[model samples]
Target chain A: MHIAFDPRLRVAGPLQALDARCKVLAFFALVACAASVPAPSWRAPVAFLGAATLLLLVSRIPLGAALRRLLFLVPVVLALAAVVPFAKAAGGEKVALWTGGPMVPRQGLLVLWNVSSKALVGLLCAIILAGTTGVPRLLEAFERLCVPRVLVLTMSFIHRYAITMQEELARMKRARDARGWRGRWIWQAGTLGSMAGTLFLRSYERGERVWQAMLARGYRGKLIGPSSAPLRLLDVMFVVWMLAAGLAIRFLVR
Target chain B: MTAPAIRVSALTFRYPDGTRALDDVSLEVAPGERVALLGANGAGKSTLLLSLNGLCDPGGRVEIGGTPVGSRNLPEIRRRVGLVFQNPDDQLFCPTLFDDVAFGPRNLGLGEEEVQKRVHEALHRVDLATLEEKPSFHLSYGQKKRAALATVLSMQPEVLALDEPTSALHPRARREMIALLRTLSCALVVATHDLEMARELCPRAVVMARGRIVATGETSVVLADTKAMDEAELL
Candidate 1:
């Protein structure tokens, strides 16, 4: 299966000029604030949704594209939400699904709304952050936050070449299809396995040659990139604003 | 006289699966020399190139400027020998062209300012200064190759080894690469099946066949060996 993460979704334009670490930290803080509030507290969800909407407007990302990208998770969210009412605890309060016996509780419906709202808010925040910032900048921020170099490098490589690998697979599939291959499920399964095996072997060999190239250029087990730009005063202000807003919503409102 | 830039004697290598890739290969490259290694497919040209940087340890004699290729000298040897693989994708693994070019210098523990300086100079050398911030995957094949070259050149290697340097370049790109190589002072050893490239870029040529050296001499004379080329099925 092909994994598609659109690089264009990464932050671009003026917002991209803001520090990446600030955006990442702000995202996590907002998610925490959104997730912790009780189901009865509709104010938290409203506040979170407002913030997300503001971010989308300011970041200049099309709302339609953001929703479309997030739509892939809708089925899974709905399925999980479907089960919430049954397992939810309520004091003898029963809710009917279709004019029959109790399939849910009143509290369970509230919990379902709570879960769905929190998930959407969190997902939207992430989508905005990812859509605005470039992958390299994000990695730089991650490294600054002390993420392991190897992990960052691995993720970057996967992001860069995963598309190329997918294209290779598509070409192989086409080649197989062109060779008088019938539409038999069993034969297709065998061909698919062979194609996967071939792709793995090719990737392994490519990794070897890449490593050798690294060695030839005096690599000695350390990954180094350009000197990261210092965190700007405005970036610090952004972080402070996020923290203040979150604390106000959490403590002041409660 | 000074030791040859690269020296290999009776070099033989077999894969872990027992496939013989190089068999008793021997060659010498002098300093400030540009030599082209010519061989058909499966003739062990790539294996020999890898041995030059100790990337393929065949347990045979390999010396760079009289220093043996071993674990103790690997870092030093690597600093002196730059090998550009056949595929630029393999060489340009970093996200940005600047980082890829600066990777070698940074690995050498140079200061940040020094690394930046070297990266700029190397990119300038390859005419890729404007592409520093561009992602490698977005680059054209010619630009990727140039970036790969800059990656190695940032390390200031004394000898450059390239595998099939002109296999997939357009005519203009090929000419640009040849001209760039000619302008550089470092010794170069290129392994390729492109005899026309050999004639244009190298002063010396070595013909390999089935993991053995078939002929070596001045580029024109060795390439003129019609009998040998006919026998090796390369003519």
Candidate 2:
């Protein structure tokens, strides 16, 4: 159940030293601008992708590790891109060129490039942000940035216990397999359904116990958190530089 | 004489489904005294620990640090009685060991400096100072159990109520825990089935069966009584 893209990097780097709030704000702004790049334009997307790669390097994240993170998102993007080249043909538009035997419409190819490029840029921005920050600090940054408390707490719990829950599911699967249940037929899905029900019950009961434990340790209505230190000069400069770069690409690159 | 660390009289509790988890239970622990609560499963040892800090709805009298256990003084009672759950996973819910250990002290409204001091001291006491930044899931079972104790220790409670602290631990870990517990000055009420641990740590022991106290005496004497041990199913 070990996931490959562990967000918490143990190495020290410039990005790791920056305040988490600054990093969060800068990376998200960049992601938003990358998402809004015009479909027909390649300059903005390429610029953003290069900037993201530079940030990744500055963050001390290995190129191989960063690329491995794309394994989850690249397949879906490629699948859609693969399908887009035929949309114009299905719509009865004229093909300007033929690649080998198949008719490749210019509009379809443009749409394919538009989708793949923007998606890759956005995904790279996210990878840089996550790979540099610890989940606890990230949650604290979200809380300070005025995200809804419910959402922050939900994400915090997921970060803390998701692995444990995954382990529980894995153990249940092993027990099911040990019972000589091959689960080859569709009708055997009844066992899977029951297993899901059992997992839900176990999780619900564990939640109760956690609440009681919280109460035992003097938890009141509010969760008191430590006050974060003020942002440093370096942090401010990093964020301002990211904003400037994003704006320059957004307005000037076109 | 100093007031008892914990006092209970005629305490009764029933689950929502009308199962009587505890019935007419009464006990007391002297200051700085270690007492073992010996019982089989379903004998209400955990229910009694829950009632110590007002975590459950129990009728009758329960007091910690001479304050009555009720909704009005629940915060104070919880700060006075540190209750450790049997499962460390349930207790160590925070993202990192430092966060988990800091949780109780932060909840107690201490300043950031004081909170940090207590967190560091607690982790140091449990020999986990180096792993404070690591996530709880990364810790082994033994480390998680000790981290669970540190979570409560940071609160500086007057009495420590531990549920099965030695259960499922290796011999070396059990020995380490026993040596660690020997260093605590506060009163302790440990609920466990490990009779050898009970003999080594507790001077007095209380045996419970069917939500009732079946036997209470010196640890060695009660454990040696074959008749009482058979009736309580401890043997």
Model 1: DockQ score: 0.60
Candidate 1: tens digits of C-alpha lDDT, residues A125-182: 7777777765656776777888898998787667646644654677677998899777
> Which 10-residue span in candidate 2 chain B carries the lowest summed lDDT?
B91-100
Model 2 CAPRI rating: medium
Model 2, runs deviating above 4 Å: A1-8, A62-65, A82-98, A173-194, A220-226, B225-227
TM-score of candidate 1 against the unseen true structure? 0.85
What residue runs in model 1 are displaced by over 4 Å at the alpha carbon? A1-15, A61-65, A89-103, A148-157, A160-164, A173-194, A252-254, B111-117
Maximum-TM-score candidate:
2
Candidate 2 residue lDDT tens string, A136-239: 67777888899898998887667545655666788799999998999999999999999999988887787778889988998874465676779899998988
For each candidate in the order shown, give its overall lDDT on alpha carbons.
0.81, 0.85
> Where's the lowest-lDDT run of ten residues in candidate 1 chain B?
B226-235
lDDT (C-alpha) at residue A89 in model 2? 55
**Span of ten consecutive residues with least summed lDDT in model 2 chain A:** A1-10
TM-score result, candidate 2: 0.89
**Candidate 1: RMSD over Cα atoms?**
3.6
